[model samples]
Target: MNGIAVAGLSQNNQSESDIQKLLKGEILLETKPYSAWGGAVTARMYLPLERSQVWQQVTDYSRWVQYFPALSRSEVLHRGDGQSKGAKRLYQVASKAFLMFTAQVEIYLKVFESIHQKTGHQIQFSLERGSFTDFSANLNLQDFKTGTLLTYSVQATPTVLVPSLLIQEAMRLDLPSNLQKMRQVLCGYFR
Candidate 1:
């Protein structure tokens, strides 16, 4: 079980297209490094599972959406040949109330093995030509005394006009909760 506790939820409208940038958008950034272009919100959690066990949970993709909230359904777009090759899976996630839109978000995820021995597994994900332009994460799982530290380093460049800050806030709220839910489900299964 990843001992992750999450609270606070926010809502918003789905206005991703044809929207003017806020004049105050510039002021919103307190610090500016011109190199900072766009994309990504990451969440980390420690779960009570061995690295290998966590890897198994994630690889068993078919059962994920069933346990995760808003992840109403999932389909295996393609399962690669063998142990090391990548497998492609498509996901249909339900829209949240905050977004104020019932969106059918499709995700194409490819699971690959990483060279780092400490990092158990790596899964590459994308929006699959949908509302969002680019969305991906490098999930790293490390061993801990009580459990495992699961960290998701996310990178996403949304094509939609919704403020990047808003998107980041939403992700900050959603990702940790999502992981906590997963931790609970996995813990229950093991128990």
Candidate 2:
């Protein structure tokens, strides 16, 4: 066997394409490197469950802190209507540790939920008041094959003069692991 030719290919690197990007149970980092705001990330996770089931879990606002590691607290302060789909106000506190210090972000978010013609279900949130300069996120749950394609898009800017690269990295790293936790909690899958 030729070592040089053999070394040129590996299983993962060879199939790195759009078709293979969302292979079941893998997290795809869809975020661009540069953004005018702090950063934006579009993380895609393939969950082997119905879109409605996933949407039900995601719409439960107060329980978000259990799924996301960075969030220390989440509470629903108000709901626009008593129905499942509508506007609501949520208060969340997220803290990330950097080396020896921890940075905490407090935000009151205006959240909305609805059914989309294409996306199956959609949940969107924007910062009403917070420690950050700006924060907004949207979550889309779409029917994929027999399961669901969950995509989360978030843009945020910190009041502190931290680099955008750092913020993006923090988001990029946390999301995959966080979704894994959510998968286990929601789907009862363990690995």
Candidate 3:
């Protein structure tokens, strides 16, 4: 489906019962392909843990490599303090193996973290310098019943020449696995 049509599917429109059902044992993931290129994806995942615990894992910049295994490196470039509050810069390298060829993508990101309203913690990030012409993402953690509901949304366009369909297809297939792996990692921490 085209980006505009698919982008119409967003968390804002989903009913409470619908989302709760989707949060069963797997992530609720959706992806859309842009006409020019690249794609956007949004996911809602339920973690059987407190929101604070989930927030700790995400904010610990260095540990992102664990969340996304394709990442070969993730490090803090600069950390904001005092007046800057939660501002930070992060550099990451991701290597993907396709057949016999390995492709590497490097990104420098400007990140910010804050409490959203009075209920949830949110992390927002955008590209500073990267292999992508444009990249931005948001991660939100909120309390849901006895556990945490984590939502991730991202839109990215790579600098490399690749078809929009191919990019969106890959996102559709890979994102769920990545998120499931993340859930496993988070749950493992308590066990």
Candidate 4:
């Protein structure tokens, strides 16, 4: 079917509009260059799984590289005591610009994850060290009647010198694909 509609879960109550949007199989993305150094990206998509399931997939740092091709390596530097605390992760990512120039970035990030039994779950991360001078992102998951609605927002600035236009272009090309890949993997999990 084009979309999933399941009952029994209170959090899964989705609006009709949301259900239609998800059935269309289109990823909603908005991006803008905030400064010469970097930009901001907001992406929204639906996944055919519950919020808890989706949260598990996103927080499974060790498996990130397997789903996201751009990631060369993802390692958990430390696991926090609980949701109230936070965790640390290190990632080595490779991106291609202009179809030929490949650039690699190493990121050290501190992540805080929370699961609200009544609402949903959230994963917020900021750069601890690495190639980016500034980087922060929040991944929010909410239950939609059919599955889960994932909203991702990121703001970043590179520490090294890189053209603004190149950074914008790379984000335009990479983010959607990476998100789609994640969706595929999540769907695969249920099967």
CA lDDT of every candidate: 0.54, 0.74, 0.79, 0.73
lDDT of 3 by residue, 28-135 (tens): 767777657788888777788988888888898898888899988999988988776768999999987744567799999989998764569999998999899899
Report the error of model 1 at residue 21, Å: 38
- By summed lDDT, which 10 consecutive residues of candidate 1 come out lowest? 23-32
Residues 1-191, candidate 4, lDDT per residue (tens digit)? 22322222222444566557665655666677857978777767788788888888888888888667977788887777656365756555655444566667888888888889777898888888888888999988987657888877788888766677767766766677788888888899889
lDDT by residue (1-191, candidate 2, tens digit) is: 11001112222233445324455456666554545448777766667888878888888877788799789899999978867456799999988896568888899999998898674788899899998888889888877667787777888888876778887877777777887777778786222
After TM-score superposition, the amount by which residue 165's alpha carbon in candidate 2 deviates from its true location, in angstroms, is 1.1
lDDT of model 1 at position 105 = 60
- What digit string (tens of lDDT, one per residue) describes model 1 on residues 107-188? 5655554635654556666555554566666666766445665656666655545666666666656666676677778877
lDDT of 3 at 176: 72
Residue 189 of model 1 has an lDDT of: 74
Candidate 1 root-mean-square deviation in Å: 11.9
Model 4 residue 22 distance off true place after TM-score fit, in angstroms: 2.6
- TM-score rank order: 3, 4, 2, 1
What lDDT score goes with residue 123 in model 4? 88
Question: In candidate 1, residue 113 scores what lDDT?
Answer: 48
In candidate 1, the residue pairs with backbone N, CA or C atoms under 3 Å apart (3 or more residues apart, or in different chains) clash, namely: 1-47, 1-48, 2-46, 2-47, 11-98, 12-98, 16-161, 40-156
Write the number of the candidate with greater lDDT, choosing between 2 and 3. 3
